[model samples]
Target: MSIHPYIEQAIELLKAMISIPSFSRQEGDVAAMFEDFLKSTGINYYQRKGNNIWIRSKNFSDQLPVVLLNSHIDTVRPSSNWSKDPFSPYEEDGKIFGLGSNDAGASVVALLTVFRLLEEMQQPFNLIYSATAEEEISGDEGVASILEEIGPIDLGIVGEPTQMQMAVAEKGLMVIDGIVKGVSGHAARKEGVNAIYKALPIIEWFKNYRFPLVSDLLGPVKMTVTGIEAGTQHNVIPDECRFMVDVRVNEHYQNKELFHLISQNVNCELKARSFRLNSSFIPTDHPLVKRGETLGLRKFGSPTTSDQARMPFTTIKIGPGDSARSHTADEFICVQEIIEGVNTYYNLLKDLYIYPV
Candidate 1:
């Protein structure tokens, strides 16, 4: 099928973005390019921190409920195995290849197309578009700060590479740093308690532990003891054994709840590194979700985290490309995927009124 003009425009924009290397915390150059595009396209937007960009429709009304569309502009550094130059954009057999192609550049351009289209028409709710920075690192300067400036938003759509499936829920992430304390002495004499021995049960507990509540879509919260370190020398019993646990949390419990539960059960000093990215979920019966279902969009829980994890309001993650293609060697997205993404985003938002008008 021949591509629509809007899709062509989105493709060109994505190519331009991918041509620039916008690694996490270094999106200034790419953001400036987008700002130039916005000005040339006659779209009104504001820059936050020289990287994050926010645009609201001219029809914006505070009286109406607002729906925010967001996608990240920053990407993880390219992997070493790419046969093609990561910063050089290429097209082959209907695919666009580059460093950030599938991860979020597709979503960013597709959403920009949707925003431009929607800006010309009437809408049931106010619309806001954010091309955010620092998502790959979850930096404080990105969406976390933008939300505070935008005030209340009734609904949100976080654009990620979900292959057009609507993600009803996404897993939250937390890292626990723990230390097992013990007396130190010569290992040959066995005169002190070994911290490694003290850590054994705690590590085992993390390995076998399960949260009581399980999500219908996301399943049980997962915990894994990913790292352990102890002992200064072969002949000395170490006084401290340090370990780290990687936790993938579900919506059944808050991060604090899980952290407290684990800490109380273990004899060691276990503390959460941060709980900023909490699990996110949107109900199946929500109007936007029902509309998506009617349009034949499938729903699933994302094991991978996204900007959706940080939104305070309800959000459904849907966009172009495949998640598996993200942050990998020779990342690419089919031209058809970007076209489908624009259509899907427009279909899910065009007619639905989140609140009775």
Candidate 2:
């Protein structure tokens, strides 16, 4: 089948974005490019704060519900393992290769095209498309920074690499720094209570303990002891052990609740870094999910974190490309994936009905 003009336009825009290095906290160059593109398309009322750019449809109204379609504009720094020039865009076989191409460039442009396609038409809801920065780092200047200015969003679609499958739920991430204190003494004489020894059970608890409830969609909350440090010298018994904990929280519990539960269970002192990215889930019976089901899209719990974690309102994640390819060497998205992504986003939103909050 022949490609639509909007799809062609999105493809060319994505290629231009791939050629620029828009790393987290440093997306000025590419954000400028995106601004120029948006202006060229005759979009009049977009807003830019830091590197985040967003625009509402012409028919925006507070009475109607809003559907937010968001994708990140930033890419992770190119890995050392890259065989091709990460800044140079190239097409091979059926794929377009470069940094950020698959992880989100395809989704960014495709969703923007979908917005353009629908902006002039009447619908039951309002539409907003955002290409934000710092998503790879989950920085404050990303989507989390602009939620208030856009007005209240009834629901959201976070565009990550999910191969066009729907992520009805996504895990939230929390990191905790902990310390285990013990008596210190000479190591050779065995005169001290070793802090590292005391830390073993804590690590085991993280590995073996399971939460009380399991989500049918998201399964169990997961925790891992990722790093540990104890001794400063070879012959000295360290008085304190420091460790890092990585938690993947499900929708069943808030991050603060899990942190409190973990603290009560362990002997060590644990402090959560932050609890901003709470787990996100939208019911399978939601109108958007029901429409997606009719279109034969598969729905599953996403183990990977996305900007969906940052949104406070109801949300689902679905987009082009594969999450496995994100942050890998020589990242690329199939040309066909962009074509299908635009069509899929358009079809999913064009006729779907939503109840306003």
- Predicted structure 1: lDDT: 0.89
Please write out the lDDT profile of model 2 over residues 1-357, one tens digit for every residue: 788887888888999999998999999999999989888878857999999999989888878889999999999998899999988889989899999999899999989989999986888899999999999999999999999998899889989989999999998899999999988899889698999999999989999999997888889999988999889898888889999989999999889999999889998888999998889999999999989999999999998888988899999999999999999999999999998898899889996788744
Best by TM-score: 1
List the RMSD of every prediction in angstroms.
1.1, 1.4
What TM-score, computed on C-alpha atoms, does each candidate reach?
0.98, 0.97
Colliding residue pairs in candidate 1:
none
Query: How displaced is residue 176 in candidate 1, in Å?
Result: 0.2
lDDT of each model, Cα atoms only? 0.89, 0.91
